[model samples]
Target chain A: MVEFNKISGNVWNIPKSGKMLVPATIYASERLMDTIKQDKTLEQARNVACLKGIQKSAYVMPDAHQGYGFPIGGVAAFDPDEGIISPGGVGYDINCSVRLLKTNLSVEEFMKKRHDLIEALFVNVPSGVGRGGKTRVDRNVIMEVLSKGAQWAVEEGFGRKDDYLRTEENGKMSADPHAVSDRAISRGLPQLGSLGAGNHFLEIQKIDQIYDEKIAKAFGLQDKDNVTVMIHCGSRGLGHQVASDYIKEMEDKYGFKDLPDRELINAPINSDLGQRYYRAMGAGANFAFANKQMITHWVREVFEKIYGSVEIDVVYDVCHNIAKMEKHKIDGKLKQVCVHRKGATRSFGPGREEIPDVYRSVGQPVIIPGSMGTASFVLVGTKTAEEITFGSTAHGAGRVSSRSAALQNISGEHVKNELAKKGIEIKATSWKSIAEEAPEVYKDIDEVVRVSHEVGIGNLVVRVVPLSVMKG
Target chain B: MFCYAPINYINLMPQTENMAEKYKFLQHTADAKFQAFGKTLGEAFANAALAMFAVMFDPADVKPKIEREIKTEGKDEKALLYNWLEELLYLLDTEGFLLSRVKKITIKGKVLEAVVAGDLVANGYKTHGDVKAVTYNEMDIKKEKDKVIAQVVVDI
Candidate 1:
């Protein structure tokens, strides 16, 4: 077992040993630490520290769990001139993200038609395994979506300018369609506006409490009982293909002889192969943005039809899996690094130009989606996070139970009944999917958020409890 | 001169009890993990595909209406296995093809060729979830005197 020394209240450290180039750090409460120790989370974090040019410490967030190469909710920054970029570091679903939509309707008003709204979303939003989306587009149009992202969706009249504006990087990045493969394109083409299965979902929530009134107001959550919607998904099959394609290329080129794990195979950040993968990853990220944009359009249509006239606006959109080149303080000097956050959210604090101009004074809004039939939290980024954790925090309540274990222990009917007891409605493609994503299979969201708050990486602004859910 | 067989010819071969004994699910916290056993490496790889499809839906419900030819090359056995499973996933995503069984497979050196049979995901078929991708995490292919066992973990 890997040993950890307590550094402070919510921080633990594993000093550099053997081939590690830097130390490994984990931010979690003692109770959480017990659960985290149950898996390979610490071992993966230590292996990440062994990567070339990894700066400071390889950090694991509060909701971390054992993943393939990097622990989920893992964060590490590598010097651009010296370090490397790994596809596995970014995750299979590139830019798997969460977007929050706020509505003017109150919870009371929403309650009257909760079932109707959820049913409408279920039928209108294409979901499930290997499902084609409602929007049919050819290869050329898919290329446009790859290059333009949400900008393409807005240009096609899928959403408003403000929607992309409120999104991360304006819902577009520097993407090169040439870097993306035809196979990836074919996989992504039909899945452009779909919410592919396995833990991806759409939830209708009501603001249950306000922790920081000022930040909550700035985020457009002014009062308790305000209705909101959350969309959690990613780039779908296109992104998966990109990751698979690159992993093979990187392995063939670099040959993973020095790496501790084969899945941790990487290419140098400035290398040609590395740059191409980054560009391809950006294209994949754009696909996710365009996807969410079209889904947002359908959601708006659903609301407009049900309520006649309603105001539903984008609050914020954040990527859960991605890599970005940014300047951060290292050794008291600002340096550029490639920050890889797999299953983690960027929590940029105030005064960062990367944030939207309207919210720059406050900070980026961090949306932490919970497991189905649970409470989700909206928090603001902090300077402390920027300084220590590379402006990153936990993505969600990380899974505590395996899929097969949940399949054996829980039934879909039982989960649905439990949610109904809490007055939450659910629509899903299959009962087995519901059982696999049972809330009991995950860590407590409340505890995870509390650690982030106490550690000062993210400050809780508001809490929203689900009223209805549509799972893919 | 290869002639296309009727769909009924393929459907006649239901999954054999011996084929059913080839794979078993293992416990993994975040993803689906399984082990497939066969007398030969090619048979092990074929069983791996069956194990992967079993994660998404009941393979018995699918009929072999369509046949897809898959070709891939890798540096070693591990890479070969990874590429083969990924190709199956790609077919599922692009053509909605669900693997009912591997009809034929031949592996020489690091190159592999296979013909897989399955049905398109259509009306009347129920799917549970999506397998995001195949991972090299804890991926192992072991060859013993009597049998070969391949273990794989898929991200869902």
Candidate 2:
């Protein structure tokens, strides 16, 4: 067992363990610790510490949960020269992320037309299971989307051009199609605009609570009516297929017969395994960016169809689970590293060139979505995050129990009815999923976002209560 | 005779009856749902393998004569169990083969080997459930008196 000292109320530090190149850190409240204790999240975090070229420290966010190899809310940085990139670190859902679009409509208008809006959203958005949008892409064009991300969507009239700038990596990574397998390409071709099942959602929400007035104003979320439609999804089935394909192929073919853990299977950052997986993962990420853009367009269309005139603009889109080359100050010198954020988001503070100009003063808006029937938060990045963490924060209220356990405690119908009773409308293809995502199955979002803010990892801006949701 | 679930059913696989008393086949309702039972160490592991495969397909569909071999070594009994099942999951994912039946399961200390057989079904054959990967979570193989029991929570 790795010995860890209680650094703070919610922080634990594991002194370097066996073969671990560095120490490990975990963030969680006493309540959150209960869930962490129930499983091997700490063990997994320590396992991440054992990676070859891991730099600085291996950290787990407050929402950490047990996952394949890395904990769900795990973070680690690897030396660009010596370290390797593992798919488990980034996860199968490649860039599984959250995108928030600001709207001109306010809470009052939304309240007046909530029912119509929710109904329109449910019908318009393609949701549930392998539910795909009507749009289909040919292999060549899909290869384009696989490369271009939101740009492809914009070029295809799915979204506006300005939206790209508001997105991370400008909604596209320089992806090479040849790096991906043919089967992976085939999978991406048919599922270009799709929402895969399990934890993916499209939510309609209003600014129900505001924290930092200045930051909220800067984010254009000051008033009550400022509605936001959050598209929570990622690379979809195509990404899953890609991750699965590579993990299997690398297991036998990578020439590393002795991997510590299969889920932690990886190749050096500059190696063939690393390059191929990154390219394919990037392609899937682009597909996700395009998928969300189209979904945003559909959301805009639904608002137009239902409320006649709705102004929805792209706020900011950021991915939670992804690995990207980033410049972070390490050991007093600035160097490039591959940061793997499994269930965390970038929390770049104040003046990063990557952020849109409008919110430069306040910092990037970090959208922390609450579970169904709970409250989601909007946080602003801070300079403290830059120094302590690798400018990252928690993604959401991580689950405390397994889906089966959730099902045992609550029925899907019961969960739906309960949410409905609270005046929120939820249209789901799988109520069983809703049950699995029951509010009780997760850590409190309020506490999670609060910790992120309190720890100076992220700053609070606004809290939005979901009025309606569509789940796949 | 065994009660077998259809491929086109609500959950991927339904509840099963195991010979071991210490371990029980968990329904789709437990946190670490769906495991195996036995009176000895090997029996529990063998049955756990069977239950995991049945989660993906019907045991009846698995033809036992066609053998698929697997080998694994672990630092301890629990790690061995996890590595063993993880290897099986990899085999299932890559080869398009589901090990619905485990003909034999033998363990010596922390090293073990097994033979399994099953067929792959179409994707989303059971839409109601999507188990991404198996896990070492909540794994426990204990010898309580004359019975041997082990439990694992798979990441579905």
Q: Top lDDT: which candidate number?
A: 1
Superposition error at B58 for model 1 (Å): 0.8
DockQ of each: 0.72, 0.12
Listed per model, the TM-scores of chain A against the true chain A are 0.99, 0.97
* Model 1 chain A worst lDDT window (10 residues): A254-263
Give the alpha carbon lDDT tens digit for every residue of B79-152 in model 2. 67766776675554344455656666667766777766665533333222344445444457777774567787
Q: After superposition, how far is residue A44 of candidate 2 from its true place, in Å?
A: 0.5
Q: Which docking category, incorrect, acceptable, medium or high, applies to candidate 2?
A: incorrect
- Number of the top-ranking candidate, with TM-score as the measure: 1
Candidate 1: residue A398 Cα off by (Å):
0.3
Q: Each prediction's TM-score against the native?
A: 0.97, 0.81
Would you list the clashing residue pairs of candidate 1? Answer: none
Task: Give the Cα-based TM-score of candidate 2 against the true structure.
Answer: 0.81
- Look at candidate 2 and give me any clashing residue pairs: A106-A225, A107-A225, A128-A472, B20-B38, B131-B156
